[model samples]
Target: MLTPEFSITQDDDFIFICIKIAAIRFSAANLEMLVDENLFIFHLSPYYLRLRFTQHLVDDERSNAEFKSQDETIRIRIPKATKGEFFDDLDLPTKLLARKGDILGADAVKAPSKSNAGPLIQEIDTPGENGNLEQAGEDFNWEISQTPMPPSDATRLLTSKYGFDDNYSSVIGVSIANGNDINELDDPEKSNAEDRVQERLRKENLKFDPEYYVSEYMTAKYGNEDDIQINGIKSLLKFTPPLVKKFLKWYKQADDKEAVMSVEFTEVEQQQMQKNLPKKTYLVDDVKKLYITMLSLLFAYMYEQVENEGVHNTESAWTIGKLAPQLSFLDQQVITESAASELSVIKAIVLTGIRRSLSYPLHRNFDLSIKVWNYVYYTLRGGKRLVIQALLDLHEVFRFHDVYYVYNTVLISDLCAWFIIAGNENIIRSLAIELKKELDQVTKKDIDFDCVCGIDESSGEVSWENMNIEEMEILSEQEYLQQSGRPA
Candidate 1:
């Protein structure tokens, strides 16, 4: 009772079977195979061999077998009976069912299994039973070594859960064969929003310059209105007073003492606040440069409250981009570590949260890091270069604010993109390896996230994990600014 080692892999249309064998001399008579819906058999010389598939290939008629010249590997490629589905009764064991662990070769190394499912299958073959090739070969008989479990679990898993009818491969916006458009069918609200945003972005020739954006938005929305007329005359920000308060308070608490000074006042702020925070005030002047930066922070605040009346998320985009630099380390770690397969889910979840905390049983909505970096780089001036420092500063201020969940939301995949933008390839690679190591044990759930290393332990009564302010690795802003090539 000898069973040859084999590995089975599958993609959308094809099932790939690899049979490893010792070198067999090439001859039409010596090497032959029989492939069909129920079984796959391979023969080498007088010693006959055969294998039964768990699922029959749909196009077994088109199945191709080739013996690779190197590695003595016999390869059989069979297209799944259906486009994306293999046969439900095709005959694979439960060992191949579990997603965990790897299946090994034929050396009785028993394809790595988490648990035994009954006994091993040892099948013997007699020539000609499976029609080995001499004018349909000769009479051959095959044996089954280990009988797999009744098809209940694997069949349910294969047919019901594991995408037999699931349109997981369908493109989001495009129409499929039934004329079903996911954008139209799945979530119209989100789809419409994306279309509107994408269209508006293209239409407006929108620039990130806060002062100049009015020719693009405000006047367009409210023509000749008093606030608009007043702001047009003075060039005051529509949301400055509120954001300024948050900014000044954040400045006092954050480690970056001189960041507030980076606010270079233009003619606008000079006219608007000449008394308290005048242009060229004793401490700092002309708040022109950091207006976009400050605007970004304010937008995060707006994003937090965007669900309220008359608050548009798209309006906050350019402004929110400016503060992308202020993302926290915890956020960065999560963004980089999140699974690639989980991206769309993360994006959807992230969009849903919108500067808010997610509830438990977290459904992988980890899109913040990706989106933040994307918009920041796309919309903010020199954002790709300055963001890492901003993220560092953000960690300081937010950790001080003690808003763990909101902080986590900011460091989404966009942050990982930022690392790439910063040319931190080696560092990003290290982080990915680190993330894979972390995932090896526990999954990346939204929990007590930390900066330095490893997942932060869960703090009581909080979203993700909350750590004390003292436990954080807050980089002093003064030091980073001095060394970071930031403008004085």
Candidate 2:
């Protein structure tokens, strides 16, 4: 049976659901709906939809169903089990469709406290210094950092056998293999220099359709982005999988949190990942944390791809390969080891993660996303720690099922499949739950007016120190002379 297009809305006392089936008419028969506790089942010959909700619904004297022949839509209204009880995640349609599953067990427990006071950032310990570092924070600290380790000989043999050791450099036109300099890779936007002109023109000439933007991108029926975010987080608290719950419980009982984040996948898990994931030798210092970073990056990229390009298809796969450089900033060759907590790496994650999480799966307004980014930047003033906290939380969620191979068998596969496959969009809803939680919490801070805005600190005025050179129309003679004095 086909799942028809649907929309959900709610008031204080009643929950409203409208399902649109193109074939339905006034004469249609066998239309049935069964409300069993929180699960609602609907069947109409060729159409079927089963939704598992967070709150209970009852069909009684106040319940009603109507069929509109003019629009061929079925509208159902059910009273809330308890008056004034709010239903969360009504905006997350795909998540509502999740099948009934086992409840989380007692093994699930709370994560470690993030309220400790101190520097929010840490780096690898240097000689003559204790492992302690200090910064300007009351007691909070950014996420922990770990450098990527070199590939072992056994791993190198596997990559060579799999013919993926080149590390996808051909697509991005840069090599970051072991021992190569990332600085030599150039800007991510200019990865493929041969097609730079065409890509720039494509970006510059794109047109915006107001109607599509409003109806599809903005999702007016889902209310606003803030509502969507809050609802998503509330759902995470209610609907996380059994494995995730158990993992949380196990983490709470662990003695060494850092060891949990650094665990390696088993050999069997490696074989499973080799089938689908890229087989190249990965340079990872902390395996779990690195995957967590990729998880955030890929989740963000998938949402943006869906909103901008419409849906997953053949083109989407190519898009992933083509834009791989911009997504992770790693190249084909690698000379130096890199850490997840490096300012540059963390900065890229923040820029991409903030923009995508705040804007996609609903509102796609460019201006609004930027405003949200600015609000987040100055609020917590701890983007690094905020992101790390989110990742750590997500890590616990992941460890429940595949503690040995969560990155290979679960996180990356689930996300990559959702990005390129059609029916797997449901996973996106659950991911949004974790992401929205972090975004909403940090955005609650009072705005910081002292935040820098590209002003020349010495002159106390707005400055063009980093203005776009291409858009520099008016220039002083001295500046022009200085430019002319430089060699091409």
Write one digit per residue (lDDT tens) for candidate 2, span 140-219: 22243432335454553332210122223233222233222212233432343223223322331222222333333223
The stretch of ten residues in a row with the least summed lDDT in candidate 2 is 124-133
TM-score of each: 0.19, 0.37
In order, candidate lDDTs are 0.31, 0.39
Q: How big is the positional error of residue 276 in model 2, measured in Å on the Cα after superposition? A: 23
The parts of candidate 1 lying over 4 Å away from their true place are 46-49, 59-61, 86-488
Model 2 regions lying over 4 Å from their true place: 24-29, 100-488
Please give, for residues 130-246, the per-residue lDDT of candidate 1 as tens digits.
Answer: 111111101111110122235555543332210001112222222224332111123221222123323322221221222232232334333467755643422322223223333
How many Å off is the CA of 206 in candidate 2?
30
